[model samples]
Target: MEFSSRARQRHLRLAGDRREPYPHSLQFYQEPPTESISLAEFESFAALAEDDYDARRKDHISHFILRLAYCQSEELRRWFLQQEMDLFRYRFHELTDSLRQKFLDHVNLSFEAVSALLSGFVLRRVCLMLFKIVGLSDAVDLFRARRVFIKDGFAFVPLKDIDAIVLNNYRKNLSKALALTARSLPSIQSDERLQPLLNHLSHSYVGPDYSVQKNTGKISLEHIDALSVKSFPLCMRQLHKALRENHHLRHGGRMQYGLFLKGIGLTLEQALEFWKKEFIKGKVDADKFDKGYAYSIRHNYGKEGKRTDYTPYSCMKIIMSNPPSQGDYHGCPFRHSDPELLKQKLQSYKVPPSGVTQVRHNLFGALFNEALFLNFISY
Candidate 1:
């Protein structure tokens, strides 16, 4: 997330600002650009022309700023990696053949050109002699596009499709570096000034602030069950399900789901009843709820405590922070916990249990595809 200084400044705010090529230094530099670039300048320079040093500097500095901010967690690292790969592929594709070769040389990414890609039939004797190994074509984007030709276990990757090699290499290196950076993050976190700034950037919300709700008190409590199934996002639908079945949500779930209900026009009086009615079903009585959970629900509407009326959490905020712990049913459905939890949930969804055991790497994905998410909306 961008800081206040960059609140209005989109790195790619310019209509033409979509290129991914940034300076690749052998070392990660600690000294960022001393001067600040305005939003107008940023838009003008978003192209990062090689001849223009200042434009390049803006791109380079912003890259480091985000790295420091996003290097805190596995989820953040994955998100950053995906974004970087997207930009990397974009910039690479925009290059001319000569420019592409120059970039390959500059980045020192050595792609083994196969006989199909070469001008003549010349096979590297060394690769031929070795045991048949897979190419860097394992990268999902390239594999999906059929850019990689595999015969007898060897991936014959063409020059036009060399992006797979580059991205695969970059992904490995960046993932390792992010992990290392996270390990050394405690030192950075020790700096009180820097810690909050990093936290803010990592959890930054860039879209419209949903804090303002003109349609408050419009949604009736009776309609929530149907509404959750019909219109709520996957994260909220899961929260709704958990709240109803378990009759309780932890602090994290309450904050995330409660703010959403408030934002969607549930009034203060309705909010109190909604939570109280649900909470009383399992553990708390009506009187206990009024004394306990009611204040917290009102607090979300700026009625108590700090009286800070919080907005509904943006999708980014939900993805980046407060990952659900054991017995918690809030957060990305696909990113939920151990095999036991997965098994229980999969069974609840009526997904075949056999598929869960078969999915070794991405257990949640194979079963919970488009249909499952559609169920969240269609139900």
Candidate 2:
């Protein structure tokens, strides 16, 4: 039987309810539809179309990314470079050796494959999206985007090896490295006032199902807002506000905020102007702006900053690859997970234990998002 509206309200209260045994009920879980193509398939497809990929690859994938995102700002470019350097210095080595090796290999392979498979028009569009994923405003920005890409590439090596031992070895090594990093980082035991928000923000996008559900209209913005209220951490709250209010956020959050702003309706010119002025606020000079910011926009937008590119709008790669850490806040959640850790974190946030297990189990199944639950119960 369909759950009554009252029953739904009661279940939701469980988020805050701490009574013994906590209430249990069968509620409709609304799942979102996923894109049909797999990452392997997408990569292979791009590899097959190498000639096209190269032409675009040469034209600068970072610019394409920024232009798409509507974030090709003079100010944004400087900040991006600065952040890349900062992250590279502080967090690169935290990655596992095996994972790192895998990343280097995959990048070489992926590059060669794409070069061989795609070029020209086909490459341009595909790169447009990939550039965005790496947090570049455009294809030209990739040289700087390299650090982030390298870091994430290792984090997301698709286990295609037929050997179980090799695959298991890869998994264990990566997990230990990530857990070690998480443990070593200073715990954010800030005031309780920030705890609820911090926990929410930290956990918010952990599930693609959340985004999918909203896009498919199975869940309303109200529900999303509610989820955000609990899972939205201070970092994300600031991010959400920056994107929604059109303010430029500094440090590592700019690329994310910039892309999100584009998602909500900011324009390229507007976004650029906003970021340029923001960088200047931190004492950057006009000369730096011209060489760095202006250059990125022109190179990425393809018309000397006069045109808007669609790079910033592409979120799939970033969302599917990087997840947040002490320094890697530019990534998305659906892509990164530490199996046991993901479960514990979800449960702590009041997600039904069953839901947590279900999500973890379905992470690698053929289908993703809503398609996994077509005709299923509505959350």
For 213-277, candidate 1 gives per-residue lDDT tens digits of 76888879999998976677656778999999999999989999999999999988888888888
Relative to the true structure, candidate 1 reaches a TM of 0.54
Alpha-carbon RMSD, each predicted model: 11.6, 25.6
> lDDT of all predictions, in order shown?
0.65, 0.37
Evaluate candidate 2 by giving its C-alpha RMSD to the native, one decimal. Answer: 25.6
Per-model TM-score on C-alpha atoms: 0.54, 0.28
**Whole-model lDDT, model 2:** 0.37
What does the lDDT come to for candidate 1?
A: 0.65
Query: With candidate 2 superimposed using the best TM-score fit, by how many Å does residue 67's alpha carbon deviate from the native?
Result: 32
Per lDDT, the best of the predicted structures is: 1
Clashes of 2: 54
On TM-score, the leading prediction is 1
